[model samples]
Target: MTDQTKIRSGGRAARRAARAAPLPDHMRPVRAGLTGGAYRPLTADGMDRIHAAVLDALEQIGLADAPPSGVAYLTGAGASLGTDGRLRFPRTLIEDTIARANRSITLMGRDPAHDMELSGARVHYGTAGAAVHLVEVDGRTYRECGVQDLHDAARIADTLDNIHFLQRPMVCRDISDNLEMDLNTIYACCSGTTKHVGVSFTDPSYVAQAAEMLHMIAGGEDKWRARPFISNSNCFVVPPMKFATESCLVMEECIRHGIPVLLLSAGMAGATAPSTVAGAIVQALAECLAGLVYVNAVQPGHPAIFGTWPFGLDLRSGAMTGGSGEQALLTAGCAQMHKYYDLPGGAAAGIADSKLPDMQAGWEQMCSNVTAGLSGLNMVYEAAGMHASLLGFCHESLILGDDLIGQALRCVRGIEVTEETLALDQMRAVCMGGPGHYLGTEQTLGRMETDHVYPRLGDRTSPKEWSELGKPDLLAKATARKAEILSRRSAAAFDPALDKALRERFVIHLPR
Candidate 1:
């Protein structure tokens, strides 16, 4: 070959290599902290109406059944205790709490590279729930969730790029005691994934012990304090204006113990909350604001996620309709309230009403995932692997959900109309000086990976090509991916010695 021929061949080889190379952190089409808020489901006037309703509910109707300490702390901080034993927060108190609440917080992964900032329109998706059953893919059967299953889910989540964090998504039904269950839940998840983990405590006393275990995993208490990788997913309230006393106490203890809290207010609309979408949002906001006040009262500027997850219910059947358009609207609306208060908040999304990972599940997952990201939620829990309306989780479904989340997050990124992105030169070259087409071009090759998202399981081939490739099955691909991910042992950043000590000290159920 001539020297010119060698040079041209070398250029082609370089371009091909670049195309095959992994995308850099900055170039990845979808990442952990993409700004959203392009799709606003609620208008300014609607938000104002909800805000007024929320404040009115807090000041007039108030919340009854505060744990004694919650009552004392809230009342001491300008909330008035009525003769009916209800704790009424003044509008002024709610405003002040919103102002003082920690707005920007980083949920640090044990791997710092995975850390995500919780502020503004930055969105992060993760798995979370209390599903008692596991969706067994092979047999298409439902079995009780166990500690090992929780660990395996975390491991699977760690391998999936779209899943930003791992909250305890299942209850360890095999464990009989509440305290042991809570402790093992923390151990199993944190051991399996270095991403920020969230767990709940049945009682306040477990908070300190869980924190100690977290400190062990984090190298030391001081290190854990500086970059706490764990958060308490505390459901601090019941619907219809009542506080879940034990959960509220657990929230306070979590705050004191240097752990972040997801102050969850999950009221099922048409049952626990008002049937109207607006009314459900009003109830959720009122309750989360109460949580906000409680957190700020306990420790001003404490890190707490405004978790206003108001679920939708099928009024006719009295069953939870987690994947309905109504649920999507509810979550998106709650996200708006979070932004309105200028507080870091989240709601549930990506839950499948279907029993399995089927066509129905795909639609359900995407609709809510897209809407939640666009609504600019800071944290979106239950963003993957949930099915049967939060009653079961599927490992294969989690893998599939990651692909769905990638597409959803790309939507969240929206359109960038920059000069380079406008591609006038590329267009001109193709139309005028190029082969009457832009098939092989510098700009196209350069922007391919950065500008587009490719799915791992989703097929995009023509019929002939698909048939040539053995007509791949998406679920089978997902099942293979799940097996591959779980086959590899988890490599959480804790030292072996620390892991040994943790296992020795705690009632750890999951085998290493």
Candidate 2:
């Protein structure tokens, strides 16, 4: 061969060798719990002003419709019952509650390895919703989600790397009884994934029974307490400054039973909450702080996630726009407020307004996911696979969302320009004497997988190569991945003995 041909062949060989296998989980370009907060939507003064308004809202208007027990708790903690029937929280009481609130807490997984430590600006993304419908990716249609769908959703999330935890996403429409539905929700999520699961209970009395089942799954109450894998996603307050009586009772039961509570205040802007973005945030904070006060009064420093999920509404039509830029701002602003209080916090993001996982969904999902990460959100829920404004969940979209979240996390990682990373010496070497390009360089090769994230479902080939590969279909690829993951998932989630016992005890809706 000619000398030129020999040199080209050697370069190609080195490039191939350098671009080796994908990095291990630890060495991947992006993973769960990466630091966010690169974006600051609210300045220090803006944050302070909003916080001051929040304090004023609680002290003045406060919240109505507190449960009798909740009233006692609030009154006992320096809150006053107004003649107008509003339970007004004193400034001192609210500040004291914030002081005593649990700033850091570990959200344990069924397997300890998946446990998430939430504090400061650490970020975690996971699935969460009450979507009642399924957006079939292949058929491009919708259907009511059943009990099995919820279980399958958890199973799908289990195999995904970027999806860090499982929150009961779908409502099991097949289950008729409320108690049975609650138990089945817990069972389905716990049985499908070992990741930390978030669940919601309908009534206060159901908690003990559910706790017993969780105890069984965790080997015993002691072990469960040691590493509680579940948390109560309680919508403790109704929007417009009112306490949800039943949910407040449930929250009380959750705190009493040693279950961590997520004090979720989901107020729709321009509808349930004030139309202005800042106003929405003020209301969310007021309600959640009331919950914090209640939890502290019941038991000092109880684990509670400050959940301030204020969704945007199309003021013209009064429709929920979970994917709107306003939604992203609201969530990011709430994250800053969480930072202001130094509490473990969570908010909703990554919901697609589109009915399907198409281009619209792409733009919508990425906008919030990226902003949430950059805003340093502690936990970003509904960050994948949700469609139809959270009315539908798709398996294929979820698989594809894993890729989307991977890219967003890489963005959150941003660019690290340290002494070693600056690459000044390497640049000089290449420019002065080495090859004119970096394609086959040692540093470039080493960073192939470490510095760059590769997508499994996304195409990265030239047009000629793509056509040669028969014009790959993104949806079809996601479908095949979903099937492979579900089929290859190892073992039934529980052993026969434990499985049979659980079945006999509760009306287990899911068949083996």
Candidate 3:
């Protein structure tokens, strides 16, 4: 080879080696729990107005249809029962509960290594939703999601570095019984991935049996209480100042069993909530604030996430618009409210209104995910795999979402300004007697891993090189990665004996 060709080859080899080298957890460009809070869609005055409106809604409008137990819980904690049978929280009572709420919480993974500390503006993204269908990898068809599909999604999430945790994403449509479905949902998620799992019980009566199953998994009630890896994603309120009676009962039961709770208040903008975004946010906050009071009333300082998930609506057709810019503004606005209260918060984002993982899906998912991350949402739920306004889940989209979220998190990390980063010295070196460029410098090599995030499936190849490699696109690459991940047994799989015991105890539909 000519000397010039040899030099080029050696330079390429060194750059490739640098890219291959791993950095420590702190040094990596992105990971779980990066601080957000940078994008404030709500101004300070706007947030205050929303807060005041929320307070008024809780105190004056109140909520109807609380279970008797919930009435006792709230009334005992200084709330009043009106002649109209509505439960009302006093302004002071709500403020006091916020004062006593848990400021920070460590969401423990079944494996300690995956624990995420949620506080301040710390942001983490993960999969969530009870999507009923699996958007087939073919990208055009759908089928009822069985227990095996849920397990496979968890297994896939376990392998992806950017997917921080796995919530029960899809319903086990094959399971007919509610009790069996709830138990098996927990079993499938826990057994598939050691990451923290979230599940919701269908009925309050199911909680006892589910607790027993959880105890069996944790070795005992004490161990489970000490490090409860699972959280109850309870929708305590329906919408527009009303309690979901059955869900309230379930939340109370889950709290008694020492499981953490997500106070989810999902209202549609034009349907359940007011059509205006501000009005929708106020209602969501009011509903979640009531839930916060309910949880703290049951047990003070209990780990409850302020889940204010208000979705957007296409007013023209009354359809849910999960990917609209209005939805992004709503989520971002809610996140600012969470920061105002200094509470750990979660909200929905990254959903695709599009039925397929096409270019439309890409833009839709990225818009919400980027906005959520930038606004510092603590638990950005549905941050992956959701399609058709959250009716379907896709493995290929989930894999693609890992790359998407990686880029979003880089935006969350933002630009760090410091002496070294200013690069005055490096600039001086380059302009003086140096290489006339920053590439291949000592600083460049050192910052490569720390300063930039690389995508696993996103293609960056040039036209000629892309043609050489058979011209791959994002979907093709994601399909291959998903297949490769599912081809092997998961490293996070449960122990054989434990799996056997769980299967024997519960009607688990997933195969061993």
Full-model lDDT for every candidate: 0.90, 0.91, 0.92
Pitting candidate 1 against candidate 3, the one with the higher lDDT is: 3
Q: For candidate 1, give the lDDT of residue 102.
A: 83
- Candidate 1 per-residue C-alpha lDDT over 282-306 given as tens digits, one digit per residue, 9 for 90 to 100: 9999998998889888988888889
Q: Model 2: which residue pairs collide?
A: 37-376
On a 0 to 1 TM-score scale, where does candidate 2 land against the true structure?
0.96
Q: lDDT per residue, candidate 3, 1-512, as tens digits? A: 99999998898788778778776788889999999989998888999999999999999999999999999989999999999999888999999988888889989898898898889999999999999999986647999999999998999999888899998899999999999999989988987899999999999999999999889888899999999999999999989789999999999999999999999999999899999999999999999999998998889888999999999999999888999999999999999999999999999999999998989999999999999999999999999999999999999999999999999999999999999999999999999999899988878987888898889888888999999988887787788887888899888777788888887877877777
> Best-fitting candidate, measured by TM-score?
1
Off by over 4 Å in 3: 1-19
- Tell me the tens digit of each residue's lDDT in model 2 across 1-512: 99999998898787776567555668878887898888989999999999899889999999999999999998999999999999998888888888877879999998877889999888999999999998897778999998999988899888888999989889999998999999999989988999999999989999999999999998999998888899999998999899999999998899888899999999999989998888999999999999899888888888899999999999888889999999999999999889999989999999999999999999999999999999899999999989988999988888999999999999999999898799988899899998877876778876777888889899999999999999999999998888887786433298779989999999999878
Question: Between candidates 2 and 3, which one is better according to lDDT?
Answer: 3
lDDT of 1: 0.90
Model 1 clash pairs are none
| Clash tally, candidates in order | 0, 1, 0
Better of 1 and 3 by TM-score: 1
